[model samples]
Each structure stands twice: as structure tokens, then as C-alpha cells.
Target: MTTPLATSSSVFLQGLALSLGLIVAIGAQNAFVLRQGLRREHVGSVVLFCAMADALLISAGVLGMAQALGERPSLARFLALAGAAFLLLYGWQALWRARHSNQLEASAGGNGISRRSALAQAAAFTLLNPHVYLDTVLLVGSIGAQQAAALRGWFVAGASAASLCWFVALGFGARWLAPWFARPRAWQVLDGLIGVTMLVLSALLLRHALTGL
Candidate 1:
């Protein structure tokens, strides 16, 4: 009774919902993106890089690369430790920012970092995290592969759309709170929240690494 168009739409929605659920979690990458957004510095490049990373990873997963990745447990373990270290460092930076909220401005010392630096940092945030590979490539990719061949593309399209929408919204929409964040106290509060998020995520990742889970 369902038209092909309707069926495709349903699959796309499923993909969008699933991808959003996975990405909406509070983690180092999202926290970095949020800070960039709030700073209004190179937000466009940051969002685009993250979305593209997810798209590439999801495509790899659909192409059966997740199986190859899954065979490398040692690689995952090594990356987990690296990721935990990076997250702890980022958390420390956030706490320092909170302590010196007077330095929190839209531009980095009124000049901001160059686009190249922003892009590099965004790429690191996207690629250096092992969980990103597991969630975007393996989990989302496996789910997308389960769809009928005709629907697989639609499913990916949906998931990609969700990622694009979320990053764009989070990056751009952050400015809407600029008035409130103009106050040093507000910036301190925001940094405090980011610091807590990074530390919590680091702890969770460290546990997962130790448990090999």
C-alpha cells in the first residue's frame, strides 16, 4: 500500500533520527564546536569539516569498512588512550578559560585564529576521537546497510542531512546568545559547563579503554 516515495521518506527519517541520537551526546568534539560557535570564529569551517567527516565515515561503514576496522582491537585501544589524554587537556583549558573569563571574547585577542588553524583543530576534533569511528562508521553504517538496496542511499542521505542541520544550527545559533554571553560571568558559566562536559567524557572514555569495552 505504500508508495516508493513514502517508503524512502520513512527510511530517511529513520536515518535522521538515529544519527541525531548518536551525535547529540555531550563530548569533546561537540564541546569544541560549541566554543568555536560561541566565539563566532571560523564557525562555518568547523561545522563543514565535522559534517563532512561524519559523511565520509558513514560511507566507509556502508561500504563494509567497519569489518576491517573491527578486526583491529589494538588500534582502538591505542586511540582510546590518546583520545583520553587529549580530552583531559581540553578540559583543563576549559577550566582555565572559566577562571579567566575576562579573556573570553568573540575574537581571539580581537584577531581570532586563521581559517587554516580553525580547520586543523576541527579536523583533529573530528578524527582523533575513536568513538566517532564506532558510532558514525560502524553503527550508523551497519544500520544503513541493513536497508533495502534501493533505500540505502536514502538512509545515508537522511543521516547526512541530520548531521549538517545539527552542526549548522549549533555553530550559527550560538551567536543568538551573544548578548548574555557578553558578560564575563556568563562566559565563565559557559566555560564551566564545557569543562565539566569534557572531564566527564574523558572519564567515561578512560573507563571504556581500561575495560576494553
Candidate 2:
């Protein structure tokens, strides 16, 4: 018979692995976190905020919120549409920066934004993206809820750990890439890529929402 400890370990590892797989992709949230990290502005708070948000969402999922969401199609559609609009606006802003910014230095220009602005942007990036809900609440939560009651907490802990570690690494490790972003053209390229990515994601979300309707 499988021991309780062993089973709990298995569940924890599964949660960790699954969460990492889902969030390792370069999406709007990750891109925003990476940018903050590169700028080295309020990195600690941003990372903490993201990690806490993920933890709360994952916990909600494990508590059966996923089922409630699944039964509410209208709510889901609204979220997708709203998220798409947010992404569209942010993408345009990124493209504008790419077009107008010339002398982009690693420790310069971008730092002018206040801490409140940084946190606000972080909040928007985290909350406005529907994919975050799909991944953390729906996918992860559903999976976690399926676990035995005794193991559910362990699973959530594992998933939360993954989020915390990933954000910490991404937010703090971004400085290493400071050298590459030092050049004006490099900033332009990075901004352009972020813009294209956001736009593509927004378009996809919008299409999904419309088709489902």
C-alpha cells in the first residue's frame, strides 16, 4: 500500500511540475515581469505581488472555484473580451515605445515611472490576462481539486512554490540581460517583440471569445 507521506510527495511534485509547464511560456505577465526585472525597479514588490496572486488563485481552484467558473459561461466570455481589450491597448503602447524610444539604457529612462505606477501595471498584467485564470484557476485548480482531501493542501503548496520560485528568478535574474538591452536598437527590438506578442495573444483571445459566443 502506498504510504500517506509518499502519496503526498507525489501529489506535490505533480503540482510543481504541472505549474512550471503551464507558466514557463513567454506571455504578457512574464514579459511584464521580465521588463520590471531588467529595469530593477520595484522588482521585489512586483515578484511578491505576482507570487501572492498565483497562490490565491491556485488556492481558490483547489477549493472548487473552478467548477463554479465552468458553469458560468457568460462570465468567462466577459473575461476573455476584457482581457483582449487590455492586451490590445498595452500592445499599442509597447509598439509606440519601440517607435519613439531611441537612447534606451539599462539603468536609465524607464526608471522614471513611480513605484505606484509599477505596481499598478503589474496588477493589470496579472489580473487582466484571461490566460492566467485558465491556467491557474481552471487547469491547476481542477487538477488540484481532484486530489484526495488530505493531499490537496500539499498540491497547492507545491504549485505556489513553483510560482514563487519562477517570479523570483525571472524578476531578479533579468538584470543579467542588462548588457544586451543597453543599446537603443536592442530596446526597440525588445519592445517590438513584446508588442507583437501581446497583439497576437489578444487576437487569439478575441477569436476564442467570439467563437464561443
Candidate 3:
């Protein structure tokens, strides 16, 4: 039975808490957002794009897109494998850029990083992540599906709001670390961290693929 409005409020709150808890964890997505934030170049667009992307992905999850994907493991594996390859490629590019473009931080280019480029990077990074489907689509969708039809919206709303909040916070909040990253040594640390993150995500996807086989 669908919960009353009052109960629905509490349920949604719980869902929001859980969703935020999961989304707040440091990942490649978070790293990219943080990097853009600290650089202070096009932060707003990056934040908005990421939040919107999350909303779309989460909506699809709740709307049964994942079920169709799950029905095709072979296809899923293909995406997973391709995603893993892309991650490895991106990891390399991120490292090269971090090393070379570390100088571009303070200098404000007239046309900084461009909206299309930022959105492309975010979408590529987000969609190519194999775990995103498992986490947002499968896990979140299942939770939403379990709730009564009326209450289900509450759960999804909580989750979607969480994603927006997380990306915005991550994108804007990283500015605090700007001074620290100004140091060349700090770039090494940041670059290394991003590199390690990409590698970890890649390994996880490969492991998942192998296990599924």
C-alpha cells in the first residue's frame, strides 16, 4: 500500500540520505568536477551539466531502461568492456593534461574549456562508467521499484536531488583547495590521485566482466 503523504515524506528523506551517502563518495566523476571547480573555469556549466546528466540517468533507471539492458548481458558486457577501455584512455589523457596544462589554471582563457567540451567530457566519463549502470540503474531502480507506485516518485526524487546536490557541492566546494593545487607538487598529488582513480575504476569493470563470464 502507498504510504500517506506524511509517511512518504519520511521515506523520501531516508532515500535522500542513502542516495547522498552513495553519491558523495569520491569517484572519477567527483574528481573531474573538483578539478574544474578548483580551476574556476566554467564551474557553473560543468555543475549543471553533471547534475542534469545524473537526473537523466536516474530517470531512465526508474523508468525501466536498466531492465532492458540487464536482459542483454552480452550487450552489457560489451559496454562494460568498451567503458573500461575508454577509462584507461581517459586516465592517460588526464595525466598528460595535468602535467602540461597545470599552468592554465590561473590564466583565464577568453573561451575557457568551452561548454560543449566540458559536457562531452562529463557525459563520456559518466556514461562510459560500467559501475554507473549497476549503481544508479540497477540498485537505485530496484529500490524505487520496490516502493508503491505513489511513493516511488518520492524515492526517485530524493535520489535525483541527492545527485544534484552532490555535483554542485563537489564542483563549487573544491575551490577551497585551489591554493594547495597551485603548487607543482600538489599537481603531482592531484594528478596521481586522478590517475589512481581511473585505474581503479577500470580494474573494477574488468573484474566485473570476468566474473560475469
Candidate 4:
């Protein structure tokens, strides 16, 4: 028979592994976080906001919000379309930055963006993406709910821990790349890559939204 400690450890590890699998992907949110990290502007606030938002969503999912959301197809579609539109705009902005690559530079000091603006962008990136909902709410939540009642809390804790660790690493670890991004050409390439990724994600999301209609 499995001891309580063993069962708890198993559940927590499952949550950590699953969450990491879902989150450690190249998406608009990751791109934005990476950019902010490279820019060294309000990285703490951005990371904190993203991690906290994820934790809230994960907790909600475990608490049966997943079932509520699953019953609402219209809401999912709306979110997809909205996310696509937002991604398209952000993609355009990234592409514009790439085109004007001369202005791209790794700042050793502060970048001119305010904390409020940074937080706003972080919120938009976190909240606007339907994938975030699908992953945290539907996928993670459903799986978590399947666990023994006593262990659901442990699962959420593990998942929340993963988010916090990931955001902290990504937001702070990016400074190591500051040397490479010191060159304008590197920034140009990075922005161009981000632009293409955002646009492709937008297209896919838009297609998903329309197909469901």
C-alpha cells in the first residue's frame, strides 16, 4: 500500500511535470517575458504577475471552474478570437521593431517603460490567451480533479510552484543573454523571430476560432 507521503509526492511530481510540459513552450507570453527580461525593465513585477495569475487559474481549475468553462463553448470561441486579434497587433509591433533594427539595443541601465505599462502588457499577455485557459483550466484542472480528494491541494501546490520557478528563471536568467543581445543585429534577429512566431500563432488561433463557428 502506498503511504500518504508517497502518494502526496507522486501527485505533486505529476503536477510539476505536466505543468512544465504545458508552459515551457514558445508562445507570445514567453516571447514577451523574454523581451522584458532582456530589457531588464520591471522583470520582477512581470514575473510575479504571470506566476500569480497562473496560480489563481490553476487553483480555480482544481476547484471546479474547469467544469464551468468546459460547458461554455461560446466563451472559448470569444477568447480565441480576441487572443488572435491581440496577437496580430503585437506581432505587427514586433515586426516593426525588427524593421527598425537600428534602434534595438541591449540596455545596461533602465529601459524607459513604466511599471504600470509593463504590468498591463503582462496582464494582456497572460489573460488574453485561450491556450492558457485550456492548459491550466481544462487540461491541468481535469487531471488534478481526478486525483484523490486529499491530494488535490498538493497537485495545485506543485503546479503553482512550477509556474513560479519558470517565470523566475526566465525573467532573471535572460540577463545571461545580455551579452549576445548587446549587438543591434542580435536584437533585430530576435525581434524578427518573435514577430514571425506571434504572427503564426495568431493565424492558427484565428483559424481555430473561425472553424468552430
Candidate 5:
């Protein structure tokens, strides 16, 4: 028989590992967060928003709130289309920047963009992506609900904690690589990779939307 303490610890570890695995990938969201971190512009707000968003979504999943969303197949389809369009546009912009900019410069506070704009963009990147809903809400929620009733809350907490720690590290720790990214070639490579990632993600979204995959 599993002790309560052992069960809780196991569930917490499961949540942490699952969340970290889901998030620590090269996607549009992470790419945007990294760029903001490199720019040193509103990194705190961006990181906070992303982390909070994840926590909120994870909580919703744990509470079985995604059931409503699951019932709305049309909503998922619409989001997939919108997300694909946005990804395509963003991918094109990244490619354009790669071709034109000599290097990706840090956006200092002098860049004139408001913190509101940064937060809004980060929000869009987080909430507008349908895959985020599918992963965090459907998959994670279903898995959490399958666990013992007493263990679900701890699992959610562990996942939420992982989200917070990962975003903070990604946002604040980005500056360490600033020196390497200061080169024109580095910018080109980075932007090229971003472009490719965006396009691939876009294609996947489109495919899923059309094929109901």
C-alpha cells in the first residue's frame, strides 16, 4: 500500500516532469519570451504573464473546467485557423528580419514600446494557440483527473511551480547568451530557425484543423 506522503511526492514529481516536458520545447511562445528576455524589455511582466497563464490553465484542467471547451468543436477549429494565420504572418516577419537586419539588437527601454504592448503580445502568444488548450486543458487535465482525488491538487501545484520556474529562468537567463547573439551571423541563424519553427508549427495546426487530427 502506498503511503499518503509517497503518493503525494510521486504525483508532484509526475506533474513537474510532465509540465517541463510540455513547455521546454522550441515554439512560438518560447521564441517570443526569449526575444523579450534578450531585449531586456518588460521581461518581468512577460514572464509573469506567461507563467500565470499556464498556472491558470493548469488549474482549470485540474478542476475539470475543460469539459465545456471540449464540447465546442467549432471553437477549436476556429482557433486552429486563426493560430495558423498568425504563425504564418509571424514566420514571414522573422524571415524578413533575417534578410534585412544586420543583427538582432537588444530593445532597451528607449525602444518606445509600452509594457502593455509586450504583455498583450505575450498574452496572444499564450492564449491564442489552440495546441496550448489541447495540451494543458485536455491532455493534462484528463491525466490529472485520472489520479487519486487527494493527489490531483498537489499535481497541479507541481505543474504550476514548474511553469513559474521555467519562464523565470528562460526570461532572466536569456541575457547570458546576449554576447553570442550579438553577431550578425548569429541573428541570421536564429531568425532562420525561428522562421522554420513558426512555419512548421503553422503547418501542423493547419493539418490538424483540416484533418481533425
Candidate 6:
């Protein structure tokens, strides 16, 4: 029916809009993606992996899959503990890199992580974090479930499309702006920022761990 089609389309549009709005805000994920893109390293796999992960999450949400996922108390506890630990570990590493890697920018040239390492790390960072599941699986899924049944699919589709488009654009687009990040000081600044972001996120996760998310 025309009514259903219209509803579905609108839902998709809404999903797409929300997804773009949320994802575009600066974060570690975006930073890494941009860095990889600028260096022209494993751009295809990284972009696709991020998008596909989003697609899976979006699909799960639309299909009301979280209902089952959310019911597992032991799994929830496990993820929470694991995520918290990871945040702390990554935060320390980021800070260490910020302090130690400042001088290496000249010799290292833009190769932050190797091609294979970049791919693996990007995938790990994107997928291994339970926070991602919470965002895409729980948060997005919950929202999708609240929508009208026919519109749900479209909404998830729209959100998934947003992830796909944004990551691709961001990854490839970064190379054009590589000139600005040429200097060692620039790398220093970048690492400092990354360190700060990691620390902040780690603190937030630690807080959630203690106070209940």
C-alpha cells in the first residue's frame, strides 16, 4: 500500500538522518578511519568492515534481536567487565604513544600502523568493543523496535546506509587533506588529542561499570 511505502521511506530517511548525525561527531573511530584514509592504507577493508558491522547491528535492531540479547544477564556482565578492561588498556597505550611516538613522526612518515596491522586493529576496535554493541545493538535496536512494524526495516536501512556512506566518504576523503598533517609537531598534536579522547572514554566506561549503565 502507498501508506506503508510512505511510512517505510520516511522511517528510512529518519534512520539515515539520525545515524549521520550521531556518527559524524569526532571520536576515536573517526580519527582512525581518517588517518588510514589519508595514508591510503587498507582503506577498502576498513571502510567496508565498519559499514558492515553497522549493517549487522541495524539489521539486528530492526528484527527485534536485542530482546533476546538483552535478556542474558551473564553475557551483559561479561561484556561490561571486558569492555571496561579494554578501555583502560587502550587508554594507557594511547597515552604512551602520545608521549613516546612524538619524535618518530619524521622517520615513520605517516605509517602509524602497518597495512595488515591497521586492518586488524581497525576491525578489532570497531567490533571487539561492547560499547559498539550497546550503541548499535541496544541503543539503535531499541529505537527501531519502537517504530511501526512496516517502517522498522526502512529505518534500520537508512541508518545502515548512513554508516556505509559516511565511513567510505571519510576514509577516502582524508587523503586530500594529508598536507596539513605533515609536520612532527602536527603528529604530536594529533597523538595528544587521541590520548585525551581515549582517557576520557575510558573514564566514562569505568564510571558506567561502577554505577550501572
Instruction: Note the Cα lDDT for every prediction shown.
Output: 0.71, 0.75, 0.66, 0.75, 0.73, 0.65
Clashes of 3: 0
The residue-level lDDT of candidate 3 at 110 comes to: 41
RMSD of each: 9.3, 9.3, 9.2, 9.4, 8.9, 9.2
Mark the regions of model 5 whose C-alpha exceeds 4 Å error after superposition: 1-3, 65-112, 177-213
TM-score of 1: 0.61
Q: Which ten residues in a row have the lowest lDDT in candidate 4?
A: 101-110
* Tens-digit lDDT string for candidate 3 (1-213): 646889689657745754564464436777777777867867888888877877776777766844555467676666666656765775676566556535213322344578788878888778899878876776566545544567767878888888888777767877665455456666555565555556665676667666778
175-209 in candidate 1: lDDT tens per residue?
A: 67445545777767766766676676567557867
User: Which sections of candidate 3 miss by over 4 Å?
Assistant: 1-3, 65-112, 177-213
**Candidate 2 deviant stretches above 4 angstroms:** 1-3, 65-111, 177-213
Give the TM-scores of the predictions, in the order they appear.
Answer: 0.61, 0.62, 0.59, 0.62, 0.62, 0.60
Q: Give the per-residue lDDT of model 6 (tens digit) for 1-213.
A: 444676678678757755664465345677778777866778888898889988997788557643543566455444555544654565566556556534211122453566688778787878787767866776566546545556677878898999999889878876654454444465556555555654554464456456644
User: With candidate 3 superimposed using the best TM-score fit, by how many Å does residue 134's alpha carbon deviate from the native?
Assistant: 0.8
Q: Which regions of candidate 6 fall more than 4 Å away from where they truly are?
A: 1-3, 65-108, 112-115, 177-213
lDDT score for residue 33 of model 5: 79
Worst 10 residues of 5 by lDDT: 103-112
lDDT against true structure, model 3: 0.66
Q: After superposition, how far is residue 33 of candidate 2 from its true place, in Å?
A: 1.2
lDDT of 6 at 4: 64
Query: Which residue pairs show backbone clashes in model 4?
Result: none
